[model samples]
Target: MDSFPPALLAFNLLLYLFTYVAATDSLTAQDPYLKDGFSLVSSNGNFELGFFSPGLSRDRYLGIWFKNRRGPTSVWVANRNTPINDSSGVLVMNITTGNLTLYSHDSTAIVWSARLLRKIPNGVLQLLDTGNLVLRDRKDENPLNYSWQSFDYPTDTLLPGMKLGWDLRNNINRRLDAWKNPNDPSPGNLSWRMELHEYPESVMWKGSQEYFRHGPWNGVRVTSRPLGIAPILNFNFVSNEDEVYYQYSVPNKSHTVMVVMNQSNYLRIMYLWSATERQWRLYTSLPRDFCDNYALCGPYGYCDIRVTPSCKCLEGFKPRSPDSWTAGEFADGCERNKLINCGDEVGFAPLNQLKLPDTKRTWVNKSMDLEECKQKCLSNCSCMAYANTNISGSGSGCALWIGDLIDLKLIPDAGQDLYVKMLASELVKRGEVQKTDRLKPKMKISLAVIAPSLGLAILFIGLYIFKKRSTVKDDHEKIEAQDLELPLFDLSLINSATNNFSIDNKLGEGGFGPVYKLDIVFGKHRANGLGAEGQTNIFEALE
Candidate 1:
């Protein structure tokens, strides 16, 4: 090879150095990001913004992704829907329009552009440590007052500090749209957004239909289910005239967490980065089980995962179609066994540890107490159920459901209470049944003690009667044997002997009366006796 001149070699080296500087530096109105290895890296070196291809596809698109990760894990895509066929893509800030625009270098054709309402004269684009690609004025340091930010237009994943809700003042609704597939970054049919109603709720949608619902905020959390305190994480929700949004943050920056809406399985999953495992660990997921399905048990019926059938009618309610319910079809829901007369006495039966029902046709009073809520519900005949709006501290506020209660579930350790309205007769019957249920265990214990005592008493009485009869029989037998053993005397002989010797025989008075001596022999025995009047007495001394 021929050696280059000294000056030419030095010039070539300087040109290469300039290119390197352009590739790594932040973007400004004067510097355009070229697809030729040019990227804007966050100050902390945690994130990078540039043009890249996803999966096996050769198409190029501008996106922001984690820099330290093993592979390309894109967090946000700018031109996901539009792909550049070649490596001629350029991301440039238009100074005149105050917009960030992506264009094809060869044809100079615009692929995508950020639409801004007001023009910014001194705009600077920078990627932040929080994975946010922001466009702001050169003079402003406040991130909240940014001209344009990727956080406001989430693609799929919700990183810490990203708001997923509405900016009422700007009329912008921030939502998450899942990717079409792992390889394709285009928006998918599945999405998650906030449903604004009298009581706002976070809802996941499969196209236009509601797929899953996170029950309305009850002052503490977004859903009715309690999410215990996570020392590393903090969740926030704001609802006022200016905005209504929900966001989460990691207090410990060392720990990373993100929520992803998985399109393949139609699931909203939360993941925590594990430093020891070097992988994202699944923390939890939404639509947690079959019971989490929206309105799976229909109106007036609640789903319980702990039960076999899962679906059950609320108190004072019966299946609308018994046959259908038995066959596992619960869409028909349930009906009040005894219809309530609006003018008659009624009561509220409380169902504990439950996910509050839907609030489409509902009313709320932030300052009202639970008792006041009950009276308000009773005044409105259409009201089906009521619950506390806020359950923090001594629970405050009131929320009443006016129509049929829908999408109820039993979330055992982590849910609120819902009081359902019922007629006086039905309440009385329910109270009686509840009373019986409470007494069942006590009744069992009482029977266990009394039954054995009664049996022992009956057994002792029977033994006493048997012993008395046995003693009487034995005495009678003894007397009969003694009488048989005694010898018999001839009454006629005794009478003649006593009459012939009456006065003479009375020689001496005895204790028995006038006595006389008599002698008799029978067989081998001889007897001596004393006769008095018409009787004879025998003595052992004479014998």
Candidate 2:
């Protein structure tokens, strides 16, 4: 047999490398263990999770941050409440209790732990490509017997496969809490939880007060924030014999999503990259506009971001205080033009393209049809509105609202049609008044021009005042110093410096001016210590 040359051998090695990469790409959950402080790189090597120290702190923390995430975007944090003071932290599973514990380098301190009541024969923690960290039992390939997992306790980020509701069997409530800051993984003031009070609603809160709500679940999506039901997202509500929990995931299984409660109490969804932009981009955010604030338009009123003022009363209602509304204060909300008569005398107005209101004090019937729901609301005068829970396949369930509407958002494609009850006489009066007002062309034009012109004038005046205040004495001092430090050069001196700035000597012209490279001898170095090359002509300036 003839031996291959060196170049031929190198070519064969390069071919083997490509084949190895291709083979690794197809592997998934094929490994049994990810050792302590070591990570199993994603098949694509786009993400890695082990342990890292954040910022200037020496404390070691176990977290799963994006391998290419823009500047430390940690999706999940383990032991956030207990950060190891040094590199002594080691994550290991105990065989006796079947618990996952964080210990010191010398195995002295148990800094943090995931408590498990039962003992497992053998266990090892594994990091799945989906960014899920699970403690798996070696005896069985099934994950049903895991000792402890990060999905049970979430930090700020909501990954695609994680559940977000209560587990009735174990009485465990899964919720996402915001981090203290970008650098610190401590719990913060903001928290997002799926409330199952009367109806299941996802809400963000700043301490005790509710900040924004995503209405009630209408089977397919949350009625208030229909964007949550986009094609990329799949909301799952499971109440079965074993578990009762709500989980959501991005439809594209290959991609990873993290819906996080940001430090500011805003719900944000970030999508991991594939090839386009190698960074996580913010895909969606709640309270995206002013209208998303809790009860911004008050009772009987609705907030519309499309409008300049963004607050308006319903058709059959008028501002409670005209003066307060004009002054940009709307706490008083709106009052009914006529009282509700509670009988067949009431007429239902179809509020199209709207997010159903908060359902904290509401009722839901899975078997009720639309006609049945309407009759139920009609019978009880307190039922302000009614809508279908599942809006697919001719609709199947009913969600009824009893209290004032709160945190309603208007969406185009995903919103459910809401039927609001109002007095027939009030509706007729409003229609007639609108017809009468439309006939007055002069009044209509005046309102259109005067209001817009006033707004423009105010905007221009505010800009002028800001410019005036910005150019004070203190600001001028900094500008003056910066100008003095930069030497100003004339075109003539620059021309002479490079023989009329010849093409050969010309460097490059940028935003400032053309720069020319000059070669000028300082002094005559005629042997007898004539100060060698004296001082080279090293002066430089921008003209």
Best candidate, lDDT: 1
- Give the Cα lDDT of each candidate: 0.82, 0.70
Return the clash pairs for model 1, or none: none
Model 1 clash tally, residue pairs: 0
lDDT of 1 by residue, 1-543 (tens): 999999999999988866664445366667645454577778788788888888888888888887767532678998889988888988778776568888896638999888664677768777888998878787886876788888888888899999989989888899999889878899999899987778778888999887888888887775555556355678888888888888899888888788888898998888877788777787878878999888899899999898889999998899999999999999999998988767878889988888888877889889999999999999998888899989899899999998899998887777888899988889899999999999999999999989999899989999999999999999999999976867655777666645655675456786887666455554455544543333354533223
lDDT of 1: 0.82
Provide the TM-score for each candidate, comma-separated. Answer: 0.79, 0.68
Cα lDDT tens digits for candidate 2, 363-452: 888889999998888888888888887887898788788967655566766678887878878767766886788878978888887998
